[model samples]
Target: GAGVSQSPSNKVTEKGKDVELRCDPISGHTALYWYRQSLGQGLEFLIYFQGNSAPDKSGLPSDRFSAERTGGSVSTLTIQRTQQEDSAVYLCASSLAPGGNEKLFFGSGTQLSVL
Candidate 1:
């Protein structure tokens, strides 16, 4: 089974442009989450979706950031207006549940570079 995978392993974008990063989670995973890791900083939660419940987008840095999970599997993160500060590793993870005890399987993120 595929653990998790991200596209464009590396991305270089101009400022004010938009980019879409894709993620394919493992089969049968019910919980999907997106997080950003800047330089040496810790992982920051962005958005999460579980089954048919409303997505938790509280962690999204701004309105420029949005995401959607389709068919309870693949997910995509889109940045409306890219900025230099937005350059970071956009990681996607999935788990059985959103519990602290459950280990999140992480995907090799899409490295976005805003020039």
Candidate 2:
């Protein structure tokens, strides 16, 4: 793809249901990141993957949230037992480098809404 791609741009699920958001990063990019942007809130880092290894996953609010990157390309974010407070835009970004503040290309994101 020319840029990052995300699936199910808008999702409405009942509380306690589980949802999975997908992200496909640019080809040849070695770094993938997941972030959450709540209304009026700045982007919060959820996880980061360099190559095939994840060096950070500390930003996830709870154990109900998890992510993984496969083959150094696509990534998925799974939210279990969704709560009303979990509503937000799940954004995915990709960079060419492994560290530092490299320019990131972001997807449109999946807006998860827990009703």
lDDT by candidate, in order shown: 0.89, 0.94
Candidate 1 backbone clash number: 0
Per-residue lDDT over 20-82 for candidate 2, one digit per residue giving the tens place of the 0 to 100 score: 999999999999999999989989999999987889998999999999888999998999999
Weakest ten-residue segment in model 1 by summed lDDT? 48-57
Q: How far in Å is the alpha carbon of 49 misplaced in model 1?
A: 0.9
Q: In candidate 1, residue 12 scores what lDDT?
A: 99
Q: Which regions of candidate 1 are displaced past 4 Å?
A: 52-54
True-vs-predicted CA distance for residue 58, candidate 2, Å: 1.2
Question: 1-115 in candidate 1: lDDT tens per residue?
Answer: 5689999899999999999999898888889899999988999999998953436889999999988888888888999889999999999998987777988999999999999
Best by lDDT: 2
User: Going through the candidates in order, what is the number of backbone clashes in each?
Assistant: 0, 0
> TM-score of model 1 relative to the true fold?
0.93
* lDDT of candidate model 2 versus the reference: 0.94
Candidate 1, 98: how far from true, in Å? 2.7
